[model samples]
Target: MLLCFVDESDQGDFHGFAGLMADEHATKAITDSLNRTMRQVAVDWGIPATTELHGHPIFHNKEDWKHVPTRVRVGVFHKVFEAIVAEDVVILLRWVHVTRLAERQARNFYPVNFPPEQVCFQHILQRAQQVSATRDTYTLIIADDRHDRDRHRERFATYQTEGTPGVYMQTNLDRLLDTVHFAPSHMSRMLQAADMLAFIYRRVHTVTESDPRASREMAKLWNTLVDSGRVHNEGNWP
Candidate 1:
């Protein structure tokens, strides 16, 4: 069985969905290693073990994140990235430029107005289906539980039963997802990894327009993912 951990990073202007797909047996080991590395970093920074390691706070320097020394923060960021890269994980991402989407809506490009979240979800599902077919294995999707969990669940159920509104015949639900599950991000290290990757992709794509340092760091991370051949991006809008 393949376990896919999914998360989203929606920064108003930029919205992205990311997933980490790995074999079910290897997922626990990967999460444990990540948690251990993060805990060690936290201890070195004098932060409590219970503290969450979110991407924005660690990379963008928010809240108590400022307490971590710059060098240590960068070290932890790279360490986490490297650890994730070292694992037998495949990264999949779907990015939507909200402004571009709004423009398309104004032009009436779509018969039905689809939310960015839904668009991202659909793309991820498509990718999941392709992966499942290629590996000939069942795939389970686990997403970070959000306030709109019920809404997402309802949408997913509809997709499974009726497919998407505009192109019902195009989506093959039966072969795609075995199930969709939700869990709190704090409780799932895999979900946390998805959050970081999504955050990095969003920040690198949008914030690089303004921040030089972010531009540099994002370039580095982007190169690492691309060069490793384990990451894929769907529908990146300029």
Candidate 2:
């Protein structure tokens, strides 16, 4: 079995879900690796490593990371991504251009409009299902807790029973083992890892750094994911 832990990030222009997938047996090892990276960064930055590593605050100079220097925080961010790349994990990403989506909606696009959350999520689920196929196994999705948990579970149940909007995709999620599950990110190291990934994903794709040095750091971090060859199922819808 596979465990797919994911988190979401939505800027006005786009909405995305990105995270790591690990073999059922490898989750603890991956978590330990990530924790080690966090512990080192915490020691260096003078913050508790056990505190949740939230990407938005870390990158935006908010909360626990505010006292840390921008360059230091950026370096820490790079290190975390590096650890993720070094692990036995598969990276998944999917998003949609909401700015364009709104324009289409204004024109009275069919079915009101495409819901970014559901669309990107289903896309990722299908991708995870494909990954599961390689091992002749199944995937169980676990996401960072959100206010819309019940709603997402309902949609997932429907998709499994009735088939996902056939007009957009054709697979029926036979490899997906159960309805979506949720957990508080702060309580789960893996979910927080997903949060960091989703945050960087939004920052890299929709938000850009005005500082040249920081921009370079972000590029290097993304390059690590690309070069590692673990990044899979990445896409942005029109």
Using lDDT as the measure, the top candidate is 2
Full-model lDDT, candidate 2: 0.83
* Candidate 2 least-lDDT 10 residues: 105-114
Q: Give one digit per residue, the lDDT tens place, for model 1 in 122-143.
A: 7887777677777788788899
Pairs that collide in candidate 2 are none
Candidate 1 deviant stretches above 4 angstroms:
167-169, 176-179, 209-214
lDDT by residue (124-225, candidate 2, tens digit) is 887888888877988889999889899989988888888887556567788988789999998887888788889888888986689888788889888888
Per-model TM against the reference:
0.89, 0.92
**Shift of residue 7 alpha carbon in model 1, Å:** 1.1
Worst 10 residues of 1 by lDDT: 167-176
